[model samples]
Target chain A: MEVRDLNFTYPDGTLALEDVSMDVHAGEIVAIIGPNGAGKTTLLLHLNGTLRGNGVVKICGRRVEEYDVKELVKKVGLVFQDPDDQLFMPTLYDDIAFGPINLGLDEQEVRRRVEEVLSEFRLFEYRDKCPHHLSYGERKKAALAAVLAMKPEILALDEPTANLDPKSVRELITAIKKINEEGVTVIISTHNLEILPQIADRIYLMNKTVLAEGESDKILADVSLLERAGLL
Target chain B: MHQEIDKYAHNSPLCNLDPRMKVISLMTLIFSVVLLPRLELVSFALLFSIALLFVSRLPLRFALHFLKWPFMFITFFLLIMPFSIEGTPVFSVGNVIATYEGLKYGVLIALRASSAVILALIMIATTKFGTLLKALEKLKVPNALIQILMFSYRYSFTFAQEFDRMRLAARARGFNPKTSMRTLRVLGSMAGMLFVKSYERAERVFWAMRARGYDGSVRMLSELKAGRRDWAFACFIIAFAALLHLVGG
Candidate 1:
């Protein structure tokens, strides 16, 4: 996945992402970090064509604008920040089954995918439970399961560790690592530098623009760099 | 407590009865009561007895309060008697005359409506609102309406919470809703903004739905099926209603 010279602004004329550029190779966990309003989420949305930025954003060498949303959503699964915004079905099973069914997969295939993710996330017990009733951590896992059930090539998450407890964060990191091992390129946006120490192999410093990108140990070690980006 | 008015709030023998059975039986009884053309003491007594027997063990005080509301409704409905179809006069007072047949007609209609109200209240008191919706869904009611009802039930609380938050925010800023027109306008705008925000939220919800794999149809985790008890209860209620309908009609 790659983005070059991408720019975007809100209708009220606030520049969100300015000339942001980055790349995610075949299989690696990339963490995009900055202070609030850093446009990390905007950049992630651009990868899936949810928010179309000005310049080129490519997934597997195919430009984002070239592929339709329905097609793109399958290839580049983007998980939003809010679980409430993601899980809408009455039950866990239905929520997980939605993507495969929409893609016109047969009923048997859809159920298989849902069953697979349920076991993977250890959400098998929550198959019948409403998403709203689940704990925040569980809901996040369920959201991730919904994305994983789609079997996307590239997985992008906004604030993957934002509201999670330590245990849930650990569980999520483990789940993402497994997905990464499956040859899926994973991108996560977060502000917590502590959790990223182990999980995030690559770091992208986004400060209303693509500030810097390199090894996690090198980029996150620079207190001056983080401070300059209002993350201190 | 008024909580007794909600029947499905606890576990009991009556709580386990099929909703369809309760609905059908109550509807039949109510129809039978309505069929009475005059204030027949026997039929009135029978209706009252059935209503009492149905509600007796659950909670009597709550039932009495529940019964009071229907009396007012009966009286209001009776007011239309004079304007309805003219009938044999029972008495005369200057220009106003009381007709026996009209009074009878009014009494019968009032009886039916009150019976319906009582039965419905008892059913509501006994059944949880969520289960009641599920029961309706099982009855092959339109899926669209059932979905709407379910969504509304879930989100109405959210809307209330949002309204409360907006109210508190307004209050913190020293804005009073009742003191002046400007504040009233602000309140109105707040409501408008809430609707807009909820609509926007609905769009976000759609995106969420898309993320999760929501196709056109909304699916439930469990399919509500009538068990043996449901079947037996349904058969008994149907037989009873049939007998009443035939015997009363």
Candidate 2:
């Protein structure tokens, strides 16, 4: 995944992101870290073409704008920060199967994929429950499973551990590692700095733009850089 | 309110039955009750609906609670019918009169309404809301209308939570709604805020859907199929309703 000179301004004249760019290679886990309102999510949105910005974002050598939105979604799964927003389907199973069905997959294939992802997330028990019925941590897992069911080449998650407990956070980190092991590129935007060292190979510190990008340890150890980025 | 209904739906005996079959059974019961010439058949239809509710394992108290809202409207119809329908006068009071035919017509109307409500309760009590939406899709409902219904059902719970939070915030500030201009103004502003928030949420939800590869069509992962028991149950209901039609006529 490649983003170059990305710039975005809301219709109300607020510059959300400016000249932000980053590169995520295959099988890599990249974390975008910064304080709130620092364009982390804005940058993630551009990864899957959910928002069109004045920049170049290419996936597998093709521009995101050139690919059909539906096709782009299959290649790059984008999971929102709020599970309520992401899990809009009436039931967990439907939300998980939504992407595969939209891709015109057959019934058996969609069912298989939905079941596989649900079990992988340890959410198979809540497969028939509504999003509102599940606890916050389960809902988050279900949301992630909904995207993972699409089997995207690149997974983009926004704040995957926002409301999770410590145990849930640990479980999610392990799940992410397992997913990355399966050769799918993972890009997450989050404010949880402590867990970054364990999951992210490379980190991009952004405050309205890409302020710094380097290996996780190199960036995590830069106290002055983090302080300047408002993360400290 | 929705969560309460969903609780019963999940545990309903007919939860595993095809939603299409359940809907069709309901419509048949309703139409048969309406078309039955004799009030006896209407009563039979009501009894049949109640029986099905029992078979579905919905508690009797729950069924009565679900029917309460419609029962109130039916009660109004019953009260006004005695004054409207022209017939032989049975009793007279100051500027008020009751007639025999009017009383009979009122009872008939009450029975029909009751049967319809009972069947509706039974259907809703048995089928999951999500499954019903899928069944509506199969029944040829317009996709846009179906989507509107789906989204409203999905997000109304969230909006309720938002409203509850706002209410608590108002209360926390020592604001109590009463018959006063200040309270009215505050409530109006609350409504406006909720509308703006809901509108923004709709936009975010659309983006979420787009991110999930939704391209105008709401497809289902599981297809509905009528098995032997589903078919048998549907046929039995239809045949019984038809039998009542012929016998009652």
Cα RMSD to the true fold for all candidates = 5.6, 2.9
Clashing pairs in 1: A98-B213, A99-B213, B6-B125, B7-B125, B7-B126, B8-B126, B8-B127
Off by over 4 Å in 1: A65-69, A105-112, B1-147, B160-196, B219-229, B239-244
Give a tens-digit lDDT track for model 2, residues A46-121: 8888789998999988999899887898899888888888888788888888888988888899999998998888
Tens digits of per-residue lDDT for model 1, A33-120? 9999999877887887777779999989999888866788788888888777777655678778777777777777888899999998
Q: In candidate 2 chain A, where is summed lDDT lowest over 10 consecutive residues?
A: A42-51
Candidate 2, residue B53: the lDDT equals 75
- Compute each candidate's TM-score over C-alphas: 0.72, 0.89
Best by lDDT: 2
Q: Which candidate is the best by TM-score?
A: 2
True contacts kept of each: 0.31, 0.74
What's the residue-level lDDT of B114 in candidate 1?
69
lDDT of 1 by residue, B131-193 (tens): 565566666778788768756655554567678899999899998767888988998999999
